[model samples]
Target: MIPQGPGEEDYGALSEQRKLVLATYDLCAVCALPFRDELRWQVTFDDQLQQMGETFAFNEAPVHEVCALYAAQVCPFVSSPHARLGDAQRKGQRRAETLTLAGFTHTATVFGHDSELQVGESILMFEMADLRRIHRLTGADDARSAYEAVLRDEARIELDDAERRVVDLLCAPTPKGEDSGPVMAGAAWFIGAVFCPQIRRVQAMKKFADAEGDLYFQLAANFLDNPEMMAEWEDSNDASTAAAMSWFRTRQSVPAVLQQWRADGARRVRDVRGRRPRAVGAAVVVPRDEAAIRRRRDAEAALRKARRRKR
Candidate 1:
């Protein structure tokens, strides 16, 4: 039996009407973009249908018309910068196959952004990386074990309550074309990201700063000496300042800090002189708008003083 949306306590007890009401959300058509033509799914099940008695407990009553209720679409896939390009190229090179529910073989792709499942004999090891492909496999016990194995192995990120609720809603089984219900897709998306790996988010952030290298160190040094430059950002209302703040949220650090560090002639601990100098020269790189920073600082100081006086 097919599972309903993520929340049902027992899918098997649902009436036919309830079962028909569940919505299905497929990977394709998620964006609601118009396509030139419709796509179809092909399905085939195990030829040797043997029943293994007393070995399995069904979570949801089996549904015979699962394929008729669902369809799959293929979309263009991309890779993160942290990911090896060669691996992406190889995946792209592989012949894309169709997804069929009834088919003897199952076809799917794994992505850093998507949820993952581990497969194979290390039953319960839960980290198997290989994707299983088979021609003939059957039995309630076998199928239940396989599905349970997949769910048990599925890796998900922890999310706050609000975010997790949204994810739960998205995972709900819905009918075709009704997958994304009343909630704006954006909300659903934010929730999905909470439980998802966020591979792209990481890759995008890494691009803004030099991570894992000496360049980052050099930048950090620049910020240490010119601390005022970094602090000035808090007061500036300029578009550039706003842009900088936006970038920092994703990258999680201020570029001005690094700039100041470099200006102060800061160097790695190992590079320090045997006898440390009592003081170091400041190497400030002033842009044409240098005065704005100083003005912002003064303004803030005056504001604080005025607030204290009023109190």
Candidate 2:
């Protein structure tokens, strides 16, 4: 099951739906429309069949299907990041898969019925947007043709200089997972630096900023120096700002935060860091050799015949 948040309990100091609004600012990650139409998901995901019981989170916000596809085409992480940074830092949850590219698996919605605990009768009530899947680009030259096949019209996705730089890295291939650890740590700087992948909503935020005149940047530029204003975002009704506030309050500059992540990741051994993921349970398994099986069966039959004769 996709992540459902801390489960049934209202978080923050707000009503349920409002808490989600605070969680994801009531907007689509791709298009920034303040409403969700379809349950959006990645085109592909790591099917760790062997680790079926383990948990995975997209750790980003929701998007329109079209937007998700658009992201699949242009967005660096969706196109394919260097690695799959799972919940290795935490206990219980298994380690994530790291690869060259993360292709689009597919996008889908949940099936549910109505009730009181689920008055809305939804498995995912308010905070579904927070339940994002992490996908990535695997190979160097792969997906480039597919990426070029589509035409993009992102006039609304306005980017400041800082954001543009990040996008540039996404489009490039130098600082990939295998080539460099630090640059490719969590597929993106904001992701690597953040405590939770769910909280690192910068990809969706590029659109969210355009929808709101880059309020986050304004807040970051202004309130980052002022403790008073920063607190207001945390306490305010503007959910996106409140979400961004979590990062600001972390106190480490984004660069420093990411750098530390890289060092820690490099220092930790792979097995010690986490287990490798191989999707299992209903997963396809290779069959044993037919001739060998027949030989074994014949031998067993001969032994049984001799034993019956002796009897």
Candidate 3:
């Protein structure tokens, strides 16, 4: 047989590598442990998390929840809720199908794989393991904060500023006899449930809020998940999730903060309404998009990590 290059030679050797026991599996990225009862796998996804009937691992490593949270916060790549990879980073092969390190899932070793398994040339093949839960870490600051708050408050479920606002908005008496949910819409609800995720603590917050507000959103969301939370919130009120998130995100600030935003929003609305064609008006160019600015900042942070990896 003709000899191939170094990369090819390594591939051939890996394809024939002997199967090893589970004890020799890869170590946890954070703790450096070979095995654990609870493990998580970071995945880069296109349309969804579980696509093509396969699960993905970030750099082929598992991590503990504590480690993952710290990484998600400090790691620029994982912190972005809408971060994307460029063609070169993706190896320039799937240019059109740009994949992002979308999220993570709880996974473990399958039954037979514990006995024996081998790594493939460029990938590892294993049976489907239990996918206990999924965490969408993109734009995860609010969600992560809520989770950490819950963890820290072991004595009692004291509502944070955001949680308190959600409960207050939910429990307020409405024109109808029953109270209504927050004003966030379906799309906004998705952002909250999947990204910001304050609604996850609705029930616990209820212990402090009230004995009522059944038709209210945060209460109903205690039992419901993403779809159910969105539907119930929309049914109770016509507000968008953005509106709800805005309230929670800024509730701690002065109450008049939203009023100032509304004033600015009103001026923008008026400008758009009154816009007219100009004979020689060159378009007034605005600065970068919010996502672009965020990407640049994150890229700097990621570059630091890359340099560390190289060292």
Candidate 4:
């Protein structure tokens, strides 16, 4: 490698080839330590860990084993047979200690605290490649963390706004007698079951049907999860899940909410036409002209004749 002049020091930055060589050596040095405190060291595995490079202190068998395991955990790729080369060429290879330090620094930037493992109680360092290895060993850490967070009251508070938004969206008047099951399932119900309950609580207080003229169908669906609750709600009859959730305030009260949503939909359809006109031309209007009138009259007459024939 050409040494850089004092004026152009940055120009001699390590090439990709040099970087790889350094990284491999770094992996080897870390593999030299016996990271496992009490575990027996297998001779073959220890040799494999070093990739048959220079051995560490003769008396430090345990230390060597620990180092080897830590190296393996950090970078298994370097120990591969394909990469190990002849002794004559390897003599001038980069120092493993320097490379290991660089690799350790790199890992700290990439994996953060989550990538840290129990190498020793006192030494809490993260391996750059350990993030991928850890995830592969178990499952995604983020998924597990999110699940844990979901069960917390703080999680409910965090999702409360989004939950309210979903409920509000779901409550908007849809087609009369339309099954709100799928909608509710996707919206408020899904939020509570998959996310948090505080969101449902926030939504329950908002008047949907009376003030907004929309029913809290989604909020109601969340409560209907329990069979016993569904039964009680049916026996007592309620307005919506939001109402039932508020009134009952426990897991048992959900059924009443489901019953209310069911009844509210039925009553709304019977009491009001369940449909309001779109402002004049906001929707396509089929004009009641002569042709349309004739078609309508013919259809009515045909229905009447069919009924008479059936009778």
Candidate 5:
């Protein structure tokens, strides 16, 4: 449950502080732990899809695929077809008949400001990659199918050539005994290219540049003008990086480049931490599964203890 205020718990409303923590650390909304898998999932409604389509940015923080499926099956508001959304911010919105379980590999923080340019609200939005439709009428069965399908890796989006190139460039190891400044510049470029919307990409880049130094900004600008310089600077750099760096280095007008990559079947890829194949005969949990519920509770307790220890 999300806390609404001091000592007040709200099932429907999200805590602003919690949302920031989840976004900053890339933690799962359900387990409040770092992701172990490549994909992140979010629950969406038919009305949202109709308005924004499959690639729409989701304001809600993402959950683990398993958590999403489990919630779909067990959460009273989610599982009931006739129930309204009950979102405090948007009251009286009826729930859609079919809900979507959308998966993605990338998320970005969008900051909103007041007239004086003071930061007001920050929303963590995710890019869609894959999805499954769940019919609320069918209840647990539909949720179960979606869960099994994800576990089987069905409908998984693989990184394409362009995307793989971008990942490789961004993740390139800095040479031993060398200044990492250039590489950090590359990191800034990566953030600009992948994590920001076009409207704010330049602003994000400027912020990063200011933090690094004026020279770093100049170098980044040079890379934007002559992308081949990135390849020349590091002989190990690949042709793909050189090909893509033009738009990546220039924070301005990079969305078109991303759109082109997507058109070319590009999908984001990320490091998988502690992801291992499930053993044969492993228990597949469904709705009203007491064992699964207990396990989740245990995991949550352990996570809380670990976090407390870290503090």
Candidate 6:
């Protein structure tokens, strides 16, 4: 079933409850299915992107990469250049000439006060480190081009020397009866880079643990005991590993780690050649000022009036 709003299924407005479920479990908003190992995609307008500047949080839940492209090709408001964002909440807002389909590994759920000053609805926010692709589109043709580009990129993934070294370290067998701190650190990097989708963080961890056996658990315990080891991991050259450590430090137990991982997957690493480590997992609240609150209230009032007039 589609996400239900106040009265019925509203494709324009996502229910707050559904948003929570999607963010908490890392499910695709369109299909309501687990994301597993796939990259998460968010649709953004040029105006919205410009308004938010370099960093922005999305109120809408993320969709699968393919799902986002499919929606862009089929949804009238999204596919048509002449269409505008005509929902009651955002009336008269013209759609931007350029739409961006951003792919990322995971998103953090930001909770804060809404216009009414209550526990505000949760929204997904992510840092640049988590981003993998930023494909821009102007029409259905661009969606098809992007889909093709995705396939080409996936088929031709080429690891650089450093990345290859990291992979080799992760795949190397640990010496029997020895500590696995170094290898586990590499595992963290690999997981952050490769399989740490928001919907399957715990499953990935479980898989690695099962394969590595007692060594994995022992290293996890060591991190819990030393805690400082996590700090040392922050010094890792891999931007993704450093970001992952930021969230990992907060979780000390298996359950806590699993819950947080399911809530927000570790930040994926970006290319290291020209990139610097960026902060990750920070939460951003919506309607930061009084003007924004007033605008939201007016929108709701307008929507109610419109509904009554239609009836």
If scored against the real structure, what TM-score would every candidate get?
A: 0.19, 0.23, 0.29, 0.14, 0.38, 0.41
Off by over 4 Å in 5: 1-14, 53-55, 82-93, 108-138, 148-311
Query: For model 1, what is the alpha-carbon lDDT of residue 189?
Result: 18
- What lDDT tens digits, residue by residue, belong to model 1 across residues 7-36? 452222232112111111112123221111
- What are the per-residue Cα lDDT tens digits for candidate 3 across 190-228? 322211112222222222224344233343232122222
Tell me how candidate 1 scores on lDDT: 0.27
How many clashing pairs does model 6 include? 0
User: In model 2, what lDDT does residue 218 have?
Assistant: 39
State in Å the error of residue 274, model 1.
60
Rank all candidate structures by their TM-score, best first, as comma-separated numbers.
6, 5, 3, 2, 1, 4
Worst 10 residues of 5 by lDDT: 277-286
- Candidate 4, residue 157: Cα displacement in angstroms equals 32
Give lDDT: candidate 6, residue 206. 33
- Per-residue alpha-carbon lDDT of model 2 for 1-311, expressed as tens digits? 87767723433111222222212222344444423233444344445422324332232344554455555556444444554545466446433332222222222211112323434322222212223334344442334543344235332445433232232322233322221112222222222222222222322222323535544333332332233444444433322233334333443233322333323333332334364322111112233446644554454355446545756
TM-score, cand. 6: 0.41
lDDT of 6 by residue, 76-133 (tens): 6546767556679778665567778888776643332232322332222333226787
Q: Which ten residues in a row have the lowest lDDT in candidate 6?
A: 194-203
Residue-by-residue lDDT tens digits, candidate 5, 1-311: 85456633221112432343344334567755445345677777655566775555665667877778877888664467565657796586554566677666655333222212225323334454545433332465688777677668634334433333333333333335332223333343332232333322222234443554544334533443344454343222433224243223333333322333222211212112223212111112223435643553454355446545756
lDDT of 5: 0.44
Error of 2 at 65 (Å): 3.5
Clash number for each model? 31, 27, 11, 20, 0, 0
Model 5 alpha-carbon miss at residue 278, Å: 43
Candidate 4 accuracy as TM-score? 0.14
List ranges where model 2 is wrong by over 4 Å: 1-19, 22-26, 34-36, 43-45, 48-58, 69-311
Sequence-dependent TM-score of model 2: 0.23
Error of 5 at 173 (Å): 38
lDDT (C-alpha) at residue 242 in model 6: 43
